[model samples]
Target: MSGLRVIPTWRHGREWLYVCGEDGGTVAWYDREADRVSLLDEARGGDALEALRPFLVGSVAVGPPPVPTPAELAGLALHPDDDLAPNRPGEHLAVALDRDPGPPRRLRADPRRRALAAQQRVGEVLDGLEAAGWRVLHAVPLPGGTYVHHLVIGPGGLYALHTVPARGRRVRVADPFVTIGRAEPQPLLRRARADASRCSYALTAEVHPALVLVTPSSAVPPAPHLFTDTTLPTLARTGGHLKPADVEALHMLARDRGTWTRA
Candidate 1:
């Protein structure tokens, strides 16, 4: 928000919406009531509304989660470019809400102790990303689906994870978000080799840049819109702050102090 114009408004309901733009490049909307913000930009992402916390804007204003509203889902734009490769570009509606959640949740439903096959599939991608100098912070299952994995690539590389299930019988999870359609391969414009998986193939057209290769399964649904724009690099994004206590303790130890005690 320092130089960006993020539009925050309300629809005809209990929801609040927000969208962003810089120098009026494009108009986006954030609707808290509908749990989503629409950007007039080119890229599309699901769960888009969750990122609009006041903190992200460097705003010290503390408040409650806004409500959802009834707006023209098709008119609200959330991106600046229309050529959001790897994802369908245009104004679309998602279940973006002001649903304040706890945190990155880990749900273990089955006691059978099954591992995520996507791990293997994603491992290849992570290896590629890391080999290409992308530091992965963490990976998690998307809320609306399973085949999709959310890999937190440092400072700003938060991308939608994907993989085609290896001829598996079933999806371990209930509802994994997904969207399946023919896509054209996009060239490696970023200075990388062009490759493709069995299910997720890279062609000339970049359909969903957010796409990833995951083991196919019924645990998730096909989510067509899931993306976000990031400023921080993968390494910087995953970097955490130093602990004050730890730093202080180290100082005392350096001075030949045994243990710390309060006077």
Candidate 2:
């Protein structure tokens, strides 16, 4: 007996069974979805097969793992400190709040909190689009201390989304101007378009601009690009703009902090 054991693990919603030696080192891993077995230690192939026999539903191609793609290679080459992939929704705001929480009691709520809530609400919906071949990067910092709230790339193409906090308030849009409730109109759409333009310059690709309204009471004059939290998932249904590889490549580029310095 080779004294090998099989351990099951899950990554990105996919199941894998790993064959380990007595020393607790992984010898091989079987990906049932891909119907492949990747051998970490070629010499232990036989032991790995034996250990994985029970979990093997059928025949699987046995070999080393596939080579990383260019996008993946770039990602792997990035230093941890320079990588933005680990950033959460409203990462900049979250950090600021951590550093300076502001007054404990306030007559009015901090606008940053409202903005963060909007970003997080939209981010949750965007994250769900990954199942449909979409990738989303949140809180992408740009030059001059400005940042993109969310950058989405997928078969539908690239979008720079700016979240608007309009909870229970009516929103009216007229090109560059956006009016929320009784507050004065703001050139939010213009800002969104500018953000997309900056992203396009940074990545050398066209990036559509869109405003995401969070739980709005009602939005006036339906716009083609404007999206509400409920309708944001429809982006996954739109396709033919780019291939899967393109989406991944763009995502890889967008997740690097240095990539936005040019913007």
lDDT of each: 0.29, 0.85
Task: Give the per-residue lDDT digits (tens) of candidate 2, residues 43-81.
Answer: 889888888888888778999878868985676455546
Worst 10 contiguous positions by lDDT, candidate 1: 85-94
| Shift in Å, residue 89, candidate 1 | 30
> Relative to the unseen true structure, what is the Cα RMSD of model 2?
6.9
Angstrom error at residue 113, model 1: 7.7
lDDT for residue 247 in candidate 2, whole number 0-100:
86
TM-score of 2: 0.77
**Cα TM-score per model:** 0.21, 0.77
